[model samples]
Target: MPPAHSTRPAIAFAVAAFGIGTFSLMDAAMKDLALAIGAYNAVLWRNGLGSLLTGVLFLGTRQRIPMLAVLKLHLWRSFIVALMAVSFFWSLTVLPLAEAIGLSFIAPVIALYLAAVLLGETIGREAIIASIAGLGGVAIILVGKFSGDYSDESLWGAAAVLFSAVVFAYNLILARQQAQQAGPIEIAFFQNLFTAAILALAAPWFFSMDATGEIPMIAAAAGLAIISLLLLSWAYARAEAQVLIPVEYTAFVWAALCGWAFFDEPVTLTTMAGTALIVGGSLVAARAKPKLVEHTEITTA
Candidate 1:
């Protein structure tokens, strides 16, 4: 059997943080693409390139065909995640990257309650507290952001992100099942391929020729996404969930830096305070989750 837990928590933590960094960087790339050609078009193109990239890596491994149930789970997740990514990427077009990510911290907490309802898991105290704190964070963010003079687009962007987070929380449930049945490359491979297929159905209405000019950026985003996935998967496989989950919060830092450097967006004090409650709540939920659930988050942002 593979090494089930990391021998060094410190190194594993760093690796996990690096993984989040790559993922955040990829998000910044996607934001640029979204700004150029719309989020739907940008994500659609990224998935197409991602499918080709991951397909090559997956085929190289020469793995056997997955079971039918695994394939079904993969397809289902692709559909859900397609919705999630498009909406969230659209949010990035209007919201500050750090603020958007801070709002997304609620996804895992939402997943906790979802597990309780769908999987029949008991609603423990930590899970309850996590939900409350996560909502509190969201409240702080909405109140702060909305209090400012802003366009309707920004308002819609925040709503879009929360909607995406709901879909993402459900995706987390499916991710746990899929993780039990597939490796990271296989999961990435099918998600990219099938999500593109699912979204391609809308090509007639939403597709843009402008996307052709953005191929290089889209390909770079896909490459960064795969690297992030591999790093997170490797670290998660070797470390306890509680050990690595906190590193997910590092996305805020990366998002902040990327937002500042790339887009000149400022991170506000309200975003920081709200992120604290959200991350604090998620930490509680992570501690309460069964060790087996470590793999569940491997597929997420």
Candidate 2:
């Protein structure tokens, strides 16, 4: 029989995939919300409310405040999160959700390399197979979606997504580290707090409630994001970055669904085919050898 820790990788991989799906659905809402408001406002309002929501939950957990080191981790990660959100959502304003997500798919690929370098995670055989399947899935989606369109603004948006993708790669590593150090509720709380704080610095200039009509939608967006973070944090705390990261590809499958339901973007055959590859890859990643040790909680002292 496998060791007790051996089962965690599959469970964590499943949880991480579910988290990505939830976040992708949130992205669809944010795209419209961002176009209605500004990207800055949409993201700012989401995080602002997320702070209150997570705060309430954190209090319910009765967890004490994290130490200074954990606080530093939250603050630093938030800076990257804030920037990544702004750029990616702003890109959504220019490109269709599917197209934007396709561009951002580069993140998982970049993150695989970062996982090895920053976190010293091994690029295991399962990880390599999963990545190939995921990238092939993304390539198929992009080919099916793009038509060699030529728009200056769209080109700029693509660039923004690519930049955000790189930052997101690093963000994944930080997430693994942070998850090891904090509970999901605590991570959710401070991440919402510090991310909002970072975005708030430009609030007087860029923020607005002019999109008040969408306040309910914004609140829902905040709820989805927080829930997703909680799930992902829980997963990362139990699994290696290599195991969890492959599941990020599953977001495209959810994104395609979002496009179909919300944006009238028809699901093409290629989408179905690509979605299959992503799911297959995720399963392979989940099948990773659980010989590795699971992450243990780091102490405050």
Candidate 3:
């Protein structure tokens, strides 16, 4: 008889997939909220609310506060998260949700290169090919956008999203380092606290009370983010990171569907073409043998 296969990894993969779906819904909520309020305000309030939820969990769980070293790492990661969130939310204001999401799919490819440079992983032929395809896909999308009647604002929005993707890649690298030192709950708590603190400086100028009715949406976004973070953390803890990485690509499909259903944004040919390359490239890069170094936990909270 064939040996019984372990169900643990399969269960973890399923949870991770569900987490990705929840994250997509959170993105849709944030896009709507960002359109209602300014991106800065939306980000500020979301992080603030997220901090509250995480703080409650942190306190209730009685996790030890991080040491100075861990706290420093947390702060830096939080700053990157703040930047990534603001840029992505800003991009959503001007870019169609599907197109923006398609462009952001280059992040895993970027992460592969970052892993090589920062973590000293070997960049194999597959990674090189994947990088080329991902970059070419991004170029095609950018050319299409610029060829049309794109406004300067739209150009800036595109730039912001691209920049966010780069930062997010680095954030993934940092997450690996972080996973060794802290639990997901502690990480989420400090991430929100630090993100809110960083954005608080601009809150006075960008804050708004007019969108009070949208508070539920903002809270829901926070809730979804926290849940996704916890689910991903749990999965990463149980299974190899390589096994879970493919689950990340499912976000593209969710984004495409949500963009159509919620915002009435049709998936264009350019988006379809670009997303194909990005997803194909990411899968190629993911095939590279992951180094035996610590597994990087993904968190968007």
lDDT tens digits by residue: candidate 2, 1-301: 1123333677778788789989998999899998999899999889999999999998887777778888899999999999999999999998888878878878888898898898887799988898899889888887887767669999999999999999999999999999888778899999999989999999889978696889899998999999899999999888888888888888887888898899988888988888789789889988887555455554453
Clashing pairs in 3: none
For residues 1-301, write the lDDT of model 1, one tens digit per residue. Answer: 2223323545555776788899999999999999999998998899999999999988898755677777888899999989999999999988888779877876766676676677565666765776677678767865776675878898899899999988977886676456555777888899899999999999999999888998889999999988987776566554444345445555776787899899988767887787788678656655553433333222211
Which structure is stronger by TM-score: 2 or 3? Answer: 2
The local distance difference test score of each candidate is 0.77, 0.87, 0.75
Clashes, model 1: 1
Q: Write the per-residue lDDT of candidate 3 for residues 162-200, one digit (tens) a residue.
A: 899888878877865676567789888898889999999
CA shift of 180, model 1, Å = 0.6
Candidate topping TM-score:
2
Order of the predicted models by lDDT, top scorer first: 2, 1, 3
Q: Residue 107 error for model 2, in Å?
A: 0.9
TM-score of 1: 0.81
TM-score of each: 0.81, 0.95, 0.81
Give the lowest summed-lDDT range of ten residues in model 1. 292-301
